[model samples]
Target: MSSNKNKYCLFVVVIGFLTTNSAYAQNYKKLDSILKTANNEIYSNPDNVIKIGEKVVKQAENNVDYKIKGYKLISDGYSAKRNYEKSLEYLIKSSQLLNLSKDKLLKINIINKTGIQYHQLKVYDKAIQYLDQAEELIAEYPYKDSVHTELGKNYLVRGFIYKEKLSCAIAITYLDRGIVELMKVKDVANSSSKISIAVYNKGNCYLLMKNNKLALENFKKAATIAREINAKSLEAFALKGSAKVLFLEGNYKEALEALNKALSLSVGVNDLILNQEIYRGLAENYLALSQWSQFEIYQLKFLETQKLIKDTERTSVSESLGVKEAELKAKKIELSNKFYYLLLILILILILIVLFFYVLVKRKTNEIKIIKDKIYLLQNQKVKEL
Candidate 1:
């Protein structure tokens, strides 16, 4: 199969790079050891991730051409642990290291990483600016196929952020555009089937926009490609996205089936975040169908996701921004409370209007009854006199 050949070719390329660049191989060993230690420390005590990250940054500070990769590893570890500020700090250091990049290719790669850092910061403008620059620089240079793959990644990230922000319309457009660009370089895509998943995420963006027809077309393509590449996680991601589309389209039975398949696959991969989303979706669908038992069960499962990722501290106003989200969770909760209060007020006004009408009718009935009784008594007196 062409897909298999592609994989073989990518493997040869990477092996050739490794074999040719003994220096990179040597650096990989050192970085690998530090990565292991850093990961272990992070798992046992996440507070250490930030500290270790700081140490890594400090070690790189004096040397103008220090290994930016060390700080990046620390940042990723901290970000995974939900320590955003420290992660953010190291990300900045990684970007600053770009100044020492004598190699044009390295400069482009660092720009891409800086773009990512800005995106996480919710400075989408700066993120896009850096990404644009990276794209321009990539076109101007001669590097491995990985350079174009990185450009594709930047577009994918931008699309993802827009989708997360509920700018689904724009997200779909960008995702489609990114997929087109990636396909043009597919023969050279050499980025493995990461390109396939990038396309997979584009389908996901379309689903979020409620375009089931378009979403279905892309999701199927992504799944087949994933299968060809033996990438089960990406397949599950596509399955999950497709299931969501089915649920939104009122195809609950099929959606439930797809969700079950997705959850089974996602569980084996130990992706707690995806599991949380699956349970949440299941709960929503069950609630709509008035399946109270299933709703309650899945709602609990959704809430349990809070236990997997570390909860960030909330002290200083800015540092308390743990999730790198532009909006606070509390703000959403506050808005919901306001909406419910407004609804309550409307219900109370309706009740008062009904009570007023009932009192007026009762008073008129009493007045009419008294007058009728008086008139009947007067007529009886007149008949007695006759």
Candidate 2:
């Protein structure tokens, strides 16, 4: 019983910290500010994040909009801190706060964020659906740079999914399209961060398709771009991708140096995805050198990272399945509507035919009556003459 009480208390703490106290922005705008601060501190200091998150939550419990935003903020903070499960929880909560919004854009943002969470979970189908919805929403939006970035991400993610499935040709096509579209976007449409991600994906496509020289070139270009924008995390990612190419080509010595730098830069950022890549590179390099111990260590790390990735993917795919189901439902509705419209048109034509025949019959009846009256008058005139 005491254990149960403790569990309940913990749940309350989690819930309370993730909601706003008022429904309107007026009463709970402070929560947003507080959440923003908490999110900022989460990567730099998890303890401070929890502190500010708690403060924000305590202040905004009943505010639906604030609660929704708060949940998303907390999710981001947890994700930055590498607490994947916690992040997923808050993002899911944020997703359920639909009643708080009438703005299509905010809803879209939430969907996009949840889609990202699904991607992290490795649930590709769900990620695709959310991303697709986000794209549809973007098409209807007045204008925004973030939407373009989201679409670019959707394409890039799709490319990654295809690459993972070993459909290198399809992956490259999508990545190339994504790159072109992202470049053409203007006026807050360009996100250097988003651009770098797409370029990295493009390089992956090249590598997977066995265009090693092009892959090497794109990776180098992306790394330079990352450095220019102060994105150490992505710079490491580009290095890691390049090193993997070298490792596959039996260039263990060079791959080893590249992997070392990649790992060094990535670990500080808690970039699990990159960490996984570096480990795989190390495993291949160690195998090349015939170092059993180093090879085993790297293999273990890679396997662990792979399992985490697979889990993330599964979550994304589950969400995507729901989206697929929703899409199927919508299509069915459209077909039903079309059928009804066709039926109504046929009925309308039948009504017109019936009305036309009725009018013709009435006119003929009146003409017959006039003819009979004339005949009766002529007969009376003949009788008078007789």
Candidate 3:
């Protein structure tokens, strides 16, 4: 009866263990699906991305990978909203987890993303530092597809950095390199947006260089690719770029037409930068055509958008300071916990060592006592024999 009861208990324990493992597997799978959805909607529905990412982060528990991914997704959402400071905060959280993870690819991705955030913040040197780290890791990473993809992104950001620095000639080189790297991937659909971005940026560089012919060609190509992918914001930016070239070439009517189309497409995109550029472009074209009233309206709209951008930037900076303070507090608490844990482990080891010595000493004493007893007995027996 006892044996049967023991077997039953063992069976129950095994079943419980398997059930726990299965539950964990299911939870992780669900989180993966949620993350995929968040990524898919990151551009069009940034708020949804943040919401889904927060859910994943809350549910990740002790899963390092999922937690990091959730943080990254949140960062991406903030980036899409043009809240670079908030985006950097989440990315820093992801970076803090790197020590707990053995996944090099994850490290590479997080570092790259951090660099991109810095670039958006106009911290060019810091951005390059992080990108350099990612590039070094990519060199050692064995997966060809992932390496190519990440490298392509790295080059793209580099191009943007140079472009922002007003080095259009150097920027074009990096953008061209990025395009080539991105095209090396087998899944063209997955990389279409990135490729289009590279091409668009290249067009911008040519426009800055006053090479209208090449600029128009690249913008047209980028717009076609953006249309195919249904990337409305990209298409709008491309159209806006086309309008700029047309305006510079003394084609006011055509520029106005392109700007109107870009404006139509940008309605729901929430891309403030693109909207500002479009408005400014429209105003320029109207002024060129001697339409004072139309030009005044768009010029006012452009200034309003510009003011809105400044306000958003100020808010981001304020929130970033708050996030920094919170992170500092968190770090202090984590350090305190680690210190206590270390002290506890040291105390346990000391106690274990003391107990081990006590056991050894007690056994030695017992053996000595037994030997002494035998000696006394032998002496008594010999005396009796005498």
Q: Estimate each model's TM-score.
A: 0.56, 0.61, 0.77
lDDT per residue (tens digit) for residues 50-94 in model 2: 556656655766666666776777787666655667777777787
Candidate with better lDDT, 1 vs 2: 2
Total clashes for model 1? 0
Residue 278, candidate 3: Cα error in Å is 1.1
lDDT of each: 0.68, 0.73, 0.88
- Model 2 per-residue lDDT at 200: 79
Best by TM-score: 3
Per-candidate count of clashing residue pairs (backbone under 3 Å) = 0, 22, 0
Judging by lDDT, tell me the better candidate of 2 and 3: 3
Worst 10 residues of 2 by lDDT: 39-48
Query: Please, what are the lDDT tens digits per residue for candidate 3 over residues 94-180?
Result: 989989998888888899888888788776787899899999999999987777778899999999998887698888889888888
Which clashing pairs does model 3 show? none
